[model samples]
Target chain A: MPEAVPDQFQGFAVDKKENWNRPKLTSYDRKPINAHDVVLKNETCGLCYSDIHTVQANWSPIARDNLVVGHEIVGKVIAVGDKVTEFKIGDRVGIGAASSSCRECNRCKSDNEQYCKTQAATYNSKDVRSDGYVTQGGYSSHSIADELFCFKIPDDLPSKYASPLMCAGITVFSPLIRNLGGADAKGKNVGIIGIGGLGHLALQFANAMGANVVAFSRSSSKKQQALELGAHEFIATGEDKDWAEKYDDYFDLILNCASGVDGLNLEEYLSVLKVDKKFVSVGLPPVEEKFEVSPFTFLKQGASFGSSLLGSKAEVQQMLDIAAKHNVKPMIEEIPISEENCAKALDRCEAGDVRYRFVFTDFDKAFTA
Target chain B: MPEAVPDQFQGFAVDKKENWNRPKLTSYDRKPINAHDVVLKNETCGLCYSDIHTVQANWSPIARDNLVVGHEIVGKVIAVGDKVTEFKIGDRVGIGAASSSCRECNRCKSDNEQYCKTQAATYNSKDVRSDGYVTQGGYSSHSIADELFCFKIPDDLPSKYASPLMCAGITVFSPLIRNLGGADAKGKNVGIIGIGGLGHLALQFANAMGANVVAFSRSSSKKQQALELGAHEFIATGEDKDWAEKYDDYFDLILNCASGVDGLNLEEYLSVLKVDKKFVSVGLPPVEEKFEVSPFTFLKQGASFGSSLLGSKAEVQQMLDIAAKHNVKPMIEEIPISEENCAKALDRCEAGDVRYRFVFTDFDKAFTA
Candidate 1:
C-alpha cells in the first residue's frame, strides 16, 4: 500500500450542472480514519439507476450540486478507527446504500438503520457529524463509513458479484427473507415482477432460499435469462392473454421491482396472492401513474402490498452468507475507472447495455499518481 | 320438535315469474339431516349487504332465478347426522357467508375454505352434491348446512351478537387477527374504516383483542356509536381535515370496511400505516374499485395494503372463543320474521338505517301451518 496520498487518487466526481454531463477522475483526499470508521479501497463500486438518476438529475428532489454517485461499495478495509472492534485493516468489507444512522434509535438498535429517523445515504445526504461533511459515495478509489454501517464480505463471495448485491440484492433480499417468515422457511412460491437488477437478484435469492422462483417481465426477451437465473417459471405479462387467471392465487409472496405502477395492475397481482399473501415493492418511481385496486382485493383474499428500502448491514451480511452458500453470482461487467470510460459506462447503463450490473474498478486506474 | 310435516308446508312459495327475485323456500321439507349436515331452526337471521345484492335482479351471468339470500344465520341445531361428532341436537350453531367447500383441496385442507376451488356460499350457491341442490340460506325458516361450516355459538354469547360474527364479524376479524400477529402478541393500533356493520364488529373485535381501536366514518354522527362499540378514537373523514396527515403512520393495521369502489383513496390510508403494517379491506361491493397508491408508500416504509376474506372454521372458533372470553358483543336490532317484513329489512339494510346488524325472529310465523 502507498504510504503517501496519491497526487491524483482515482475518483469519478460529477458536477451537477446541466452543461457538465460527465464524471471525471481526480485527486481525492482521504480523511485520517476516525475512531469509529473504516476506509475502503474500492475494488468495485456497482453502477445503478440511482447513480444515473443522481448524475443526470432525472428524479425529483435530486442533488442540485456536485455529487459522487455510487453506493454499492465493496472492497478491503485499508484502515480502521481505534474504536472499531468488528473490523481491522486489510479485512474485506462492503457498504450498501446507507452510510450512517442514529445508533440510539430503536430501528438502529434492531439493526434496521436504513429506516432510522436520522439516516444518511451514501451520496447526496448531509452527514450527521459535528464537522458536517456531506456524504460522498464509492465512485472513487476509496470511501469511508461508520463500522456499524459496514459489512464484512464473505471470503468466497467475489467482490464483482457482491458489489451489486450490496444495493440491488439487499433491496430485494431483505423483503423476501423478512416477509417469508425469515431466512429459514422454504417451498414458498416467490414471484419476482421484473427481470432487471433487483428482479434478477431477487430471483437468484428466492431460488437459493428453496423457494419456487417465478419471474415476471414485460418483454419475452428476458424469458431465457430469467429461467437461466433459476426462475422456475417466466411470465411475460405483455404476451399473455388473461394471464392473471392462470396465476390467480398462485404466489405466496410477490416482489415487484418495476419502477412504473402501470406495468402491473395491482388488483390482478392481489388476485394472484393467496389468502394472507403479501405483495412487496422496492422500487421508488413517480406517483402520477395511477394504481387502481379495489378494497375487495384486500378484503376477500387477506393479501397485502407494501415496499422495502435497502437492507441494513445485518441483512446485507445475511444476504451475503446466503449468496456464498448458494454460490450465487450476479452477471456483471467491470469497467476501468477514468473520466471518458466512466461516462461511457454510465451511458451504457442508462441505455440498458449491461446484462445485469456495472462495477467501476477505481483501485488500478490512470489517474492514480 | 314437530313429529310430522305441516300440511301448509307448500304455502307462500317463490313466485316462478319473480323467482329470480328470491328462491323457493316453501319446499323446505326439513328433511332428515345428513351425516355432515347440521339442521339449524332459525331464531335470528341478520341481513347482510350481500343478501340484497344477490336478489337485486340486475347483475347475472352466474345468477339463478331460485337464489336464496341470507348468510348471517343464528339458530339451534334441531338434529345431527349419524356421522357427525362436533354437534348434536340442541347445540346452538351459526352459519356465515360460506356453507360448503371441497375439503380435499389445498385451501380447504389448510382451513381456508373461503378460497376453496369448489366452495359454496351460504346463499345463491350451488351445493356440491351429485344432484346439486341450489343452496338456500337463512331467509327461510330452516337452514341446513355442512357441519364444517357450522360454528358453535358460545354459551354466554347472545344469539343476535353471535349471528353477525358468522359473516360481518369474521370478515374484519380475519384481517385484524392475522395482521396483528393474532390476539396473544403485542397489541397494535388498528383502524376500522367505515362504521357500518363490518366496521362496528371490527372495532369490537380489535378492542377485545387488546388493540388500540380507531373508527373511520364518513359522518360525525357515527362518533358516539363507534366509541360505544369499543373504538378508542374516531376519524370522520368528512369532518376531519388532514386527518390522514394528522395520524400518518399511526396505525399498525387499517381494516377498510367500505363496500364501494367510489370515494375511497388508498394512498391517503397507506400514509397512516406504519412500517410492515397492513391496510386490509373485507367489504366486497359488486364493482371493482381502483386504489390510487404510489409504489413508494409500500417500498420505502415496507408497509402493506391488501384484503382478507372470512376466516376458516378454526379461525371462526378462535374468534368466537375470544369473543366469549372478552364478552365482545355487537350492537344489533331485532325484527319479527314474516313475509310482509322481508322487503322492509332489505330496504332498511340498504339505506343503512339499522344500528349495526338486524336479526330476524318469529320463524314460526313464516313457517307455520
Candidate 2:
C-alpha cells in the first residue's frame, strides 16, 4: 500500500435530511481493499441529478447518516490489491454508478452486471462482498472499486470531460449502441427528448454513430445549442401544437432523456415512432412516478416501451472508446471541490440552471486535512 | 358481377345493445364494388374471443343497429372489380379483421395497412373509401373487401383451419415473426402465455418457426395439451409459487396470448425475459384495462413491453405460407353458421367450453334464408 494513501478520506456529505442541499465537508472510512480492489485518488467527479436525488432521499431514505453522493468519478489509481491486474498505480480510470456486482451470476458473466440482483451502487449502498460496508463514492479523496467496474480513461479524453461520461454518457450511449445496431446505425433516425445534461451527450453520441439525430425539447431555447451539439433537427414540443401530426411515425428510435416525467405526454412521443420501433426511457422520474399507455397505443404500431440503467462494464469501456474516437465532449461547468461549491452545484442542478453538467475539480486542495 | 353474388347479404345481427348476446338474422346492403373490390361467397369463419367481445359490446357499444360481428373469414371469390389482379373469380380468399385501408399512405404502402389511421374493420366499421357504408363481416351469405386487405388461401390449407389463421393466427404470428427474426428463430427460447384461441396458434407458429416453445397456463390441466401442441415445456403458473424464481431471465421472447388480463402479474412475466428481450401482448383485454409497471421493472433487465394488432396482408400471406409449409393446424371445434348456432358458439366460447378455437362452417345451409 502507498504511504501517501490516507487512512481516512474526506468528502462533501449530507448529514441532515432537511438540509440535503447544504452538504458539509466530512471524513469517512473506506472498506479494506480486497484482492480485486483498486484504490483511486479522484481527480474530478461529475455532479449528477442522481446526486441531488440521493441527498434529498427522493428515491429512498438515506441509508447512511453521512451520504457522500457522486458516482461519475475520474481518477488515477493510487494502489492495487494483489489480484488487481486490470489497473496499476498511476493508471487513469473512471467509475460510474455501479461499483461492484456478484460476478458469479449469469448476468454478470454475460456482460449485463448492471442488472445483477446483488449489484452495489457507487455510494450509499451496502457492499455485500466486503463485510457489508456502506460504500462511499468519488466525492471523497479516494474511492475503492472492484476492477471489473473500473474503466480505463482513454488517453485522448481529459479528466474533466470524462467525468460526466462515466454516468451521463453511459446512460444514453448504452441504449443507442444496443438498439441502433452499433456501427451499422448509419442513416437511422434517432429522436432524443430533453436537451439537458444527458440529452446533450445523447445527441453527440448518436450523431457520432452516424445516426440522423433529432432533439426534442419543451421550448425553442435549446434549438440552436442542440444543433450545435450534433442534432440535425429540433422539435420544440411546447411550441409546436401539431408536432405529433408533423412527425407522425417519423422516428426509428426515440429515447426519453428528460430529467423528470411531470406533464410528459408519453402517447405523443410514442406516436412518432415507426412500426416495431422502441421508445426507451433513460431519465428516471421519482420512484413513485409511472408511465401509463393504452394497449392500443402499442398495438397501433407494434411499438415497445422500455428503460435502461447504467451500462455494463464492457459497455462502459466501449462508451469511453467511442467518446475518445469521436472526440465527444460534454458541455461541463467546472467547480472547485469544497463544501460550499458542492452545495451551490446541487442547488443549480436542482434548478436546471447549469448549461450542461458540473464536474468538481481541485480534489487535493479540498481533501487536505 | 356473378349471379351467385347477392344484391343484399344476410347475416346474424345484434340489434339492441342490451340484447347483444341474442343476435337476429337480417339482410343488409353491400357497398358498391370499386376498382379493387373482391366479392366472396362466404364458406367458413372463425369465432374468435374478439367476436364475443365485439357482439357483447365489450370493446365499444354496438356501432350500428343490427351490427354483424365476425372477422376471420374464408370463402371463394365470386366477383372481382376491374383493377383487382390478385384474385380472380372462383379463387379461394380470406379476410382477417381489417377490410380496407387508405392504400396511398406510407403505412399502407409499406405493407402495414393494419396500423393505418383510415383502416376499416371487417365488422361495424365505416368504409371511408366506399361511400361510408357500414361493413358487415363473415357471419353472412357473402363478403366484400379490397384486394389489398384480402389474401389467397394456400392450396394445401383448408378453409376450416385457415379461418382462425386470418384473425387469431395473424394477431400472434405478426409479433413472433417481427421480433424473433422470422425464419431465423431456430433454438430461441419463446414463452406463450395462456392456451386458448390466440395462444394455441402462437405455440404452433413459434414452434414451426423453430423456436424452443414454453407454454404458461393457469393449471396443470393444459400441460399435456400444450406439450402435444409443440411446446417443449409447460408451466402451470397457478400452481407454481416459484415460477418466476425458477425461470428468471429465461426467455428470449414471451408473447402474452392470454385472453384476459384479470390477474396477470406483468412483473413476474417480465422477470423471465433475458436482458434486452421483449414481452409482447397480442391479446386485447377490455379497452378500459391498462398494463402498469414501475420504471425500475423495465430498467432491471432492459426488457420491453409491447403489443401488436392483426398482421399486414404480406405478413398474413407469409403466415399462411408458413402454415402450409410446416403443416401447422389450429385446434378448432366446428359449428354451423346460424342465428341459434352462432349464439350457442358465443355462449360456449364465453364459458371456455371449447378446446381452443371455434370455426363456424356449413355457411351455405345456415345462410340459405
Candidate 3:
C-alpha cells in the first residue's frame, strides 16, 4: 500500500540554483513516515558549525539543490510508522547528527553505528533508504527519521535548552566517557580548549562529572563567564606565553574543542597532559594542514589522542538522563524560526557573535497552522 | 666513613675525549657497591637499537663523557649490599632500559616509575644514587645497580633467550597489557607490524594472550616464518596495494612495531582498526618527520593512537611472569662479548641482518678474567 501524503510544511532551505545561492523560506511537500520512521513536529533546532558547513557547501560537495540543514533537533512526535514501537504520538523526541545506518553491519550491531561506512547524517546526506532523494534536516516545521536514530527526550527538559545537547553535548561527552572510563570521573582533572559553544557545554559536563575543569581560550576575556559556566580554572593560551609549559603533566584528560588551524600549538597542550593521560579532539581542522605528532613525545609520556563523532543513540539517552540528574543546563539564546531570522543567525554564527548557541523556535505557524 | 672499594672489573667504554669518538674494548674501573645496591658478574647482555642510538649519538645529546652502552643485562649477583633484600649472592637477575627512579614520587609509587622525569637508564643516564659516576650497563663484567631495578630471572627461562626480554620483551608487552585492557584478551584480533625483534616477541605475547594475530610486513617473504612465530594470518602491504582497504575495521588491537620512517602509510593501517580500537606503537621514528593525523579521520572512526615506554619495574617483573607462564620466548642469536663482535652486531642490527636479537656473552673474560 502507498503511504499517505502529509500536509505541506515550510522550511528554510539553501537554494543552490538561485542567483546568489542563499537560503530562502519556501513551502515543500513532506514525505510520509516509512515503516520504522517517526515524523516529528519540529519545536526547536540548534545551529551548529556543521549547519553553516552544509548551507554554504564548505567541507564537501553538496549534492542537493535545495537542502534544509540542522541536526540538533527537538520536537513532539506527531506520527509513528507501523514498525516503530519505541515512540507514540505526543512523545517528546530528538534526532542528533546521525539519522540512519545499516543496522546489519558489525559496527551497527556492536554499539558503534556512528562509524559504520553506510552511516547517514541528518542533512544533505544520501538517503540510503531507497538510495534516492536526500535526507533533509531539522530546519523545517517537520522532520522524518528512523526510529533507530530518534531519541525520546526527557519530559522535564525544556526543548530550547535540550536542542544543543543533542549535538554539541554528545560530541565531547562521548570521548570523555569512552576514553577516560566514565563521565562520573570523580576527582579527575579535565582540560577543555576553545571556550565557545562546544567548549562551554563540555566544561559544564566535565564539571558535573565531579572533575576539576580547566578552560583554555585565546585570552582571559571569558574568565568570569567560564568560571560561571562551571570551569574551575581558565587559561588564556595567547595571553600567557608559558601557560602550556607551566602546567606540565597537569591534565588527566584534555578535550580539544578547538582546531589547530587557528595557530594553536598542540604540542604545548600535549605537554600539559599527565603520564598515561588522554587527549581527545572533537574539532576538525582544515584539510590542508596536517598536525605533526612526535613519536618521541607521545611514547615517552605514554599519552594518547582520540576523536569522537556525535555519539550513539544509547549515549544520547544517557546524556539526557545525566543532564537531568545532575541539573546540567546548556546555555543558549532562542531565535524565532523565520527565514529572515535564520539568515541573520547564520551570519552571526559565522562571525562568532553569538554568546554560545542559537536555537530556533516558533514552529506552530510553519507547520499545522 | 667512605665505603670500602670492591674488586674492580673491566668493560667496553666510550671515552668522549678520544679523537675518533667510538666505543672500544678498553679497561675501565667499575664503581663500588652501595647500600641497597647489587653487584653482578655479568653473564649475558642483549644488543638493542638503543645501543646504536646511544653509541652513535643519533638521538638526544650525550651528557656522559665515559658512557658504557648496554641495558638488556642478565647476570648472577656476586655481591649484595647490607640492605639488599630481593637478591642474595649467586642470585640471577636482569636489568632493562631503566635503572633507577625517585621511588617516592607519585608516578613511582603508583607503579609508573618508567615515566618519572628523573628516571635513570642503565647506560649514559643520570644515577639517582648518591654515587658520583654515571650508571654503567651490561657490557662490563661487574656492574652496580640499585635493588629496585633488579628483576629476578626465572629458573626455567634460559639466560641467553631471556636477555632480550628484559628490554625488547617488556617494550611491546607493556602496551598490550596496559592499553588493550589486561593481557588476557582472548579471541581478539591483533596486528603486529614489522616481523623482526620487537614484532616477533609481540606476536608471541599476543598469541599467548589468546588473541588472533595478523603479521603485516613489507612483503610475503616472512609468511612462513611469521606463521611459525604465532601469526594466524600474514599481510604483504607492499605487494598488495589494497591490503589496508580489504581489511577495513578488522583488528581490535594493532601494535605498530614498525616505524613511520620506513615509509609505512600509517593512515592506511589505521583503516584496519575497528571503532574504539587502539593502535599503539613502541618504536620511535625519525624526529624530523611528523605523521599527519586528520581530525576528520580520527573523529569519524573513533579510534585512538598511543605510544608506550618500556614497562615499569613491577610491570617488568609481571611481564617475565607472564612470559614464563605462557612459554613466550624471544628469538635471539648469541655473540661473544668482544669489542670486535659487539661492533659488528651493532652494524648488522642496523642492516637488519640478525634473525631477531643479538645477545653478547663471554663477559667473564671481558671483565673479571
Candidate 4:
C-alpha cells in the first residue's frame, strides 16, 4: 500500500530574485489531482542549468514568488488518479522539463508535445487545467503530473543515474536519433560541442549510436574524460588556434551543448559542418541570446542552424531503454536534498564547478529527518 | 555542321562600379579550351539579380576592370574540346551560376560540386584551371565553359524559358526537392516567400512537386498573378497583421525566396513552420547581411534556418527534366541583347521593375547584325 498523501508539499523555493541562490524550505499547495494525474513521492531530482537560469531570472523575471525549479525528476508513484492507466500506485517513473501539453493539438498528437503551443514547463509555468496554480517542480517532497508526461524508468537503470537523463539526455538524444539515421548511425562523423552535462551524454549517445563521435571543449581538461565517455577524438578548441581550419567541413551533425554563448564563434563552428548537415543546439544560453550568422556562411557549406526542446514522452522512454542497454550513465555527484545543499548546488552549477551533473537524493531525510 | 568559333567573345561589360547600370559593349578573351571545355554560340541569356549585384559591387568590389556578369546562359554548342563526350558540335545547352569545380573532391564526386572549395562561378570568379583568367559570363556572342557544367536543354523547353531555369529555377528547385521528399511532395504545406524571379519559379516547382503551395508577397498586387502561377493560396504579408498567428505551426517547408531581407520578420515566418521542419533561403541578398534569431525562437517549434547555393549539376538536370515534364515555365519578358538593352535590363532589375524575369535574346543582332 502507498503512503498517505499530504495536503501540502514542501520543497526549497526561491521567494525573491535577490536571494535566488539561497532558497528557503517552504510548503506550497498542490493542484487538485486530475483524471490523468499521478502523484510521485520524490526520490531524486537532477540539478540542471535550467534550474539556475530560472531562479536567477536569466530567461525572464521570476514570475512566481515561490518558484520551485527542478525538472530532471525521478520518483515513485504514491497515488494515481482514476483515469491514469499508465501508472499504478507504486510505479517508478520520471518527468523531464515538460509537465503537460494540450493533447489535442497536431504537435501533441504527433509525439512532439514538447513544442505544443500550450505546453507547460515543469516549473514556474501556469497549469492550464488549474485556476491560478503555477506548476511546481521536482525539487520537492512530491510531484504530481499528468501520467502521459511521466515515463517509466527501466528496471536496469538506477534512479540517481536516470535523473539527469530526464532533461539533458533526451535533449541531446532526440536530435541525434532524428538526424543521424537513428539506431544505426555508423560511420557518420558527429561532433559534440562543450562537454558539460549535455555534451558528455551526447558523446555517449552518439557513440552508442555507432557514430564516429568527436568531443570539442574549450580546453584539454576534459580530453581524457570525453574519450572515456565515448568520444573517438577530442578537440581542445581553445588550445588549438587552427582547430576550425583543420576540421573544416568535418561534422555530419554537431550538437551545441554549451550552457553559455560568451566568446562562442558560431561561424567557426558552422564552418566545420558537412554540406546539407545541421548544427543543433539543445543547451539554451538565455532567452535574449541570439545566434547570428551571415546567409553566405550557411550558403557556403549548405548548413543549417536549429534547436530542439526536450524530447517527447515516447522519446524519453526510448532514451531510458537505450541508456540501460548501452550503460549510458551521467557522471553525477549525489547531494542530500536540503535548502543549503540546493543553494550550494545552484551556486556550483552557475560557477561551472560540477564535473558533469548533480542529483539531489536523501529526499526522506531532508523532509522528515 | 556548326559555325566556326570566334577568337574573342563580345558582351556588355560593367567597366566601373559607379556606372554599373550603364554597361558598355566590349570584347574579352575566353579561357583556352580544355579537354572538358565546350564553346557555345549564345542565343538567349537571363538577367538574374546576381548580375546586378555583381556589376553594382553589392556582394564585393569589382575585382576585374570589365566584368561580363550574366550566368543564365542558353545557346547551341559551336565547339567541343577533344575530350568532350557529352555533347556534339550542335547540341543546345544551358549553363547556370557555377562554371567549373575540382571534380576530384568528395563534394564534386557526390553531386554537390556547387559547394566545392575550388568551385568557379560563371562570371567574376577566377578560373582555377587557368592562370589569371577571370571568367566572363554570358550576355555575350559566344561562351566557353566546362562541358560538365553545360546541361542539354530539353527540346520541348524554349531557349528563352530555359535561360532563367538555368539559375533561378534550379536555385529554388534544389532545396524544394531536397527537403520536400522529391518527385512527389503531395499534401505538404509549402510556402514560397517572395513572388519575384526566384519566388515565381519556386511556386511553379513546389506546385509541380504536388505541394499545397502558398505564395507570400509584400502586397495583394500579385494575388491574381500568384494564383495563376500555381499558388493554391496567396498571402499579402504586409496586408495581414495576423497571418503569422493564423498560420502558426502550419508550413511543412518554407522557401524564403525574397531577394532582400529588408523588414523581413524572420521570427514571424519561423513561427508558422511545423515542428522539425525547415525554412530554407535560395535568394541571395548582399553578402554582409546576417540573419539573427533568438535560440528560443527556433527551440519553440524545432524549426531550422538554412540557405542553398546554386544547384549541383545533377540537380540542375533533374530540375530541367522536371520543368520540362510539368511545363514549369518562368514568366519572362524578352529583351533584345545589346549594350543599351543590357543597361536598361540591369537598371530595371535593380529597381525591381521587371515582372518576373528578363531574358535577353537576338544575340546575333547585337553582335553581327
**TM-score of every model versus the real structure:** 0.86, 0.96, 0.93, 0.98
Task: For residues A262-290, write the lDDT of model 2, one tens digit per residue.
Answer: 78888888888888889999998778777
**lDDT by residue (tens digit), candidate 4, A1-369:** 668889899889998778889988888888788878889999999999998888878888777768888999999999988888889988899988888778789988988988889888889998757766888998899998887689999877889999999999999999998888776789899999998999989999998889999999989999999999999999898899998888877889999999877688888888888899998988888877777766777888888899898888888878877787889999999999898899899999989999799999999987751
DockQ metric for all predictions:
0.53, 0.70, 0.65, 0.78
Report the lDDT tens digits of candidate 4 across residue range B1-369: 568777777888889889998888888777888878889999999999998888889998887878898999999998898989999888999998988877788898888888888888999988868777899999888888887689998888889999999999889988998888776899899999999999999999999889999999889999999999999999999899988988988899999998877678888888999999898987888876777777777889888999888888898888887887888999999999888898888888889999899999999898861
A1-369: candidate 3 lDDT, tens digit per residue: 323335676688887623212567766766555788888888999998888866665566667767788999998888888999999888999988887777788888877787888888988887657456677888887888888889888888999988999889888788878866787778788999988879888888888888899998988899999999889998998889988767876788899887454576767777778887778888766555566676776865788777778888888878888899888887888998877788788888878888899999887765543
Q: Give lDDT tens digits, candidate 1, residues B262-342.
A: 777666777677667777777766653466676665654577777777888998998888888877777778887665566
Q: Which parts of model 4 have CA positions greater than 4 angstroms off? A: none
DockQ score of candidate 2? 0.70
Q: Whose lDDT is greatest here? A: 4
The most accurate candidate by DockQ is 4
The docking category that best describes candidate 3 is medium
Better of 2 and 3 by TM-score: 2
Model 3, native contacts kept = 0.82
Better of 2 and 4 by DockQ: 4
Better of 3 and 4 by lDDT: 4
Tens digit of lDDT per residue, candidate 3, span B94-212?
88888777777777788888887778888777688656666777887767787878889988887888799988999999888886678787868899999888899998988888889
Q: Give the local distance difference test score of model 4.
A: 0.88
Kindly indicate the candidate among 1 and 3 with the higher lDDT: 3
- The TM-score of predicted model 4 comes to 0.98
lDDT for B16 (candidate 2): 66
RMSD of 2: 2.0
TM-score of chain B of each: 0.89, 0.97, 0.92, 0.98
Question: Which portions of model 2 miss their true places by more than 4 Å?
Answer: A1-4
